[model samples]
Target chain A: MQASNAMAALALAVGASLALAAGSAGAAPPALDEQLDGAAPVISVPWNVDAAGTAAQAETLLAPTAWAEWSNVLGIDLRPGGSGMEFTSNPDYGTFWCSNGSSPAYAYARMHLPHGSTIRFFRMWGQDLSASGDVMAKLRETCLPNVGPAATPTVTDLATLQSSGSSGSFTVTSSPDHVVDNHQCAYVAYVQFPSCDATTSLRKLRVQYER
Target chain B: MTRTPFIAAVFACAFLSSASDAADFPNRDFRVITGVDGKPARSDDSYSYASGNYRCTNASTRATPHVVRYPFNLPEGTSVRYVSVYGRRTSDATPITLRLRQVCQSQSASDPTSTVLATRTPAGNADGYFISAMEFSPSPNTLDCRAWVEASFDISTTACDASKAWIQRVLLETEPSDRIFRGTFSVNVDYTLP
Candidate 1:
């Protein structure tokens, strides 16, 4: 009995020492990712919403060739310079603004955050070429009623941020209500560039969320 | 003291060591982004919310011209294992296609590069629902370390056929690059040294 007790104590002591050595020798501490239940860590998703090769709708009733001339609610025209989208600037017509027409023309980019994700913040990467004109980004959430007949879904702006200078990025922190409740909401990231300077553009959007 | 307590202590130590080792592997991560989170590829491709999902219908008469791209924001060095797109077709003749696309941009290059990892089009059931899946193999799988990944869904039929397709959700299954935790940790859990 004494021999067994001594052996067990020695084995435990050796095991504990080895474990302490590992923990001290750069073994990372237990983290959320290390959890057995598969709880997700904070993940940041980057979206290049302004990439080329996609088409947008035109606000005016025109041919497919002219649809890129006007910024539509679905999307916007890609800038001729690079991988970005901007409002169309026609020499014949002045700068087109979303607030100009009877029907507002705000460009939209679909947001894909993981289900049950709580948005921490999102960054808008782009250039605001004009100092006078500002670029606005609004995170809109529309939740359809579960028990109703197709009524107009209540649209809410969870957060909105903008920049007027030639900044490369703008970060908008989420409020308490920024959770992605997919059971009742659909999220859309909207960007409206009030300038037609050709350089004023929206390049990319990054969403950081926790699941 | 009794030998029972000593044996129990030894067993407890062993269990703690095993847990620490298990932490090295971490848990496989997954993300299920709904189809409503995606945007239409063009204005002519209209979408309506139905049953808590986006039902997209193409307006163009061309074959498979309508597309909806869903962006993925996983960490760098994320080994994507499987991609499954959930959707249904309104017409029996039409099929829904899911494509896994990766884009890599070099610092010296003027244009960003892109590649298609996999493409799958699943057959619809009697209820018109289908789950298009693509799985990668050989251990490491497809790593999205320095690239951008997205799942683009294409409606296989022409708009003139009155066949519409909508995605219910996209499931992305991935494993960490190495046997270590590389990203942020949850603040809710209290982690301590073993």
Candidate 2:
């Protein structure tokens, strides 16, 4: 019995030591290359509601293009740029500032890069609305005014482009004509709305990406 | 020096050692989750689907062209070869595609640098619903691939075939996505290699 007890004790001691050694050796597991690499860049297109009965109608019209899950939401954060982003923490329908009849709303999205990937820009094309007339779309960086006042962002800075139209209602679309920066490890995309109201709205945004 | 005592001791020791190792193993369940919500008023455009064709629903709370992230863990051996993805659209029947493989070779543990393995589309269908399959091996060296369905459903499909999107938010499959759901959900699929 003593021999058995002694052997058991020795085994326990060895096992415990092995476990401890392993626990200590492993610092932290590195992050994985899951979806970011292949996943498309995040694109935020603030819906422009300018048509007659547009705000309510656009929702039903673009139901299919709507986000389906929590994961589909754009991930956006304030970057380290000279000018920062501005949004309401508890916005009823996004941060509202510009007027289309009611408060204009915007959407934010976020994505992660491989820490050192360079993003080459491409030409941007968008329509005023999904079921549109003349193409009307633009892109921009952060929505401004710090929830107070904004510079009425345009495609020049944020790449916001106003689609040409014979009618008044239009959808804006745009992307970087220049290079896009991959800050640290995060990449943010913002869709701003200066007058994405009842007369004009934004829809369908795509970013052509390259390695 | 008795043979019986020695044999019994050896057997007993072997059993106890194995039991300890098994206990140390990741025998418990774990989960994987990922997603996004940047622009609110943009309308919900993104969607999610799981194995056995389980779809995620978007309440009228959030909007679209969003970001999504899911976290899932795996045991020593897990395969990541194939997964499926589904999307919806409205009057615009364009597809929002998702790829299944990574672009770069990476370390065995976690690979966040490898690019997505699938292509993006403006449309979604069963033809669009496949994931690549590889040898089932998740170890300490070779990185298992991760996938992403770049965009979400279309406005046309969501309105007309909204039922399809509704019956299941849509489809997004990974061969061993089981790596994530195995421990947590009631998933009992075989991962043993044939």
Candidate 3:
């Protein structure tokens, strides 16, 4: 009876050690501190007037055609010139300004974030290019869950920048409902004229978000 | 008895390694399906059926004259890495310029309303039915092929989540002049998932 008891005790000890090892191995990585509000992430694309010197240069900086390249080029150029464009920390805000020429310009800024991030707020400062026409800004999101030939993505409009006249600045905050499941998001700002001759200039633009 | 624990450890290690090696992002390929004639099939599982001859009257002026669209879906954590297109041209001398677009469910259902992603003109070969391939970088700043004319937007994001997303669609228009031709084309996409 003593021998049998010894064998049972040995078995139990081995089983317990194995269970402990398994538990240690399965432990998850340390969680990020949720209490601290880190610096907001920022992605900026400053406008390069030099790059747009020629049609081909504009196409290279923008796209193939005039109509297709305008908005995309403007989108990349909205950043403040110099070292501010560097993406070192998560920036809570961004600035977009354009003052030169105006011929019904539209711009978009796109960024990719870790999935499940939330956009907390947006701040805008702008001077209307035209006294009669209004400028509009929109926040758009697209999510691609699986990357393959069979994969489809969902697109949603998170928010819209309130229309501003020739001069004004505004700040808007997003609700918790603004959280996104996908990784890709963008901000589109456009200025339309009543006539083909109208033009608009954007002096300031910013966005804030949390991962 | 000790050998049993060692075996279990080995098994656990193997499982963990394999799980890490498995594809985080899905890769997909589409191919052409030919008929009995051995030529490019007009309508099959591989290609979408379009009425009438695929013609480009003023290829240079025509705005997305002949567009062939293939629908796809990307779940949540995945983003595009590279997109490649392969096809044949009727004349090796006549280069074919094609534009690739991404149609998101939230954006637009129609092909014309979709966003233009990239454009490429594959170099032609002497052989009439020679296969040509072109690749596009996932970034809007770079072009994988010299023939690429434009890089409008990048698809490196997890936001493409929908049941009916148009992953790839080609807009065929005449770049040099008017032309009418029948050819076969397909797309292969590489992606990364979290």
Q: Estimate, for each residue in A132-166, the C-alpha lDDT of model 1 and write its tens digit.
A: 66667787788898776988989988778676454
Q: Write the per-residue lDDT of candidate 1 for residues B99-135, one digit (tens) a residue.
A: 6654432111223345566777666566677777777
Candidate 1 chain A least-lDDT 10 residues: A65-74
Provide DockQ values for all models, in the order shown. 0.04, 0.03, 0.02
When 1 and 3 are scored with lDDT, the better candidate is 1
lDDT of 3 by residue, B98-153 (tens): 45444211001110113445656554444323232333333221100011112111
The alpha-carbon deviation from the true structure for residue B173 of candidate 2, after best TM-score superposition, in angstroms, is: 6.3
For each candidate, the alpha-carbon lDDT, in order, equals: 0.47, 0.31, 0.30
TM-score leader:
1
What does candidate 2's lDDT look like per residue over B88-194, in tens digits?
A: 33223333333332222221211123334345453335433333222212322222322223333333333323234322122222332222234222121112200
Show the lowest summed lDDT stretch of 10 residues, model 2 chain A.
Answer: A65-74
lDDT by residue (A41-61, candidate 2, tens digit) is 443223333434142111111
Candidate 1: CAPRI quality band: incorrect
Q: Is candidate 1 or candidate 3 better by TM-score?
A: 1
TM-score (all chains, Cα) for each model: 0.44, 0.29, 0.29
Global Cα RMSD, each model:
15.7, 18.3, 19.2
Index of the highest-DockQ prediction: 1
Give the per-residue lDDT of model 3 (tens digit) for A1-211. 9999999999999887665443321122111111122243332222111111211111111111111100111221233222222211001111233332243334444433334545554323333345676555566676565555655656666666544344332222222235655534433333222222213333333333443
Which regions of candidate 1 are displaced past 4 Å? A1-190, A195-200, A206-211, B1-26, B59-64, B76-80, B104-110, B124-127, B135-157, B160-164, B177-194
Q: In angstroms, give how far residue A94 of model 3 lies from its true place.
A: 21
Q: Which stretches of candidate 2 lie over 4 Å from their true place?
A: A1-104, A122-158, A166-186, A194-204, A208-211, B1-31, B34-173, B176-194
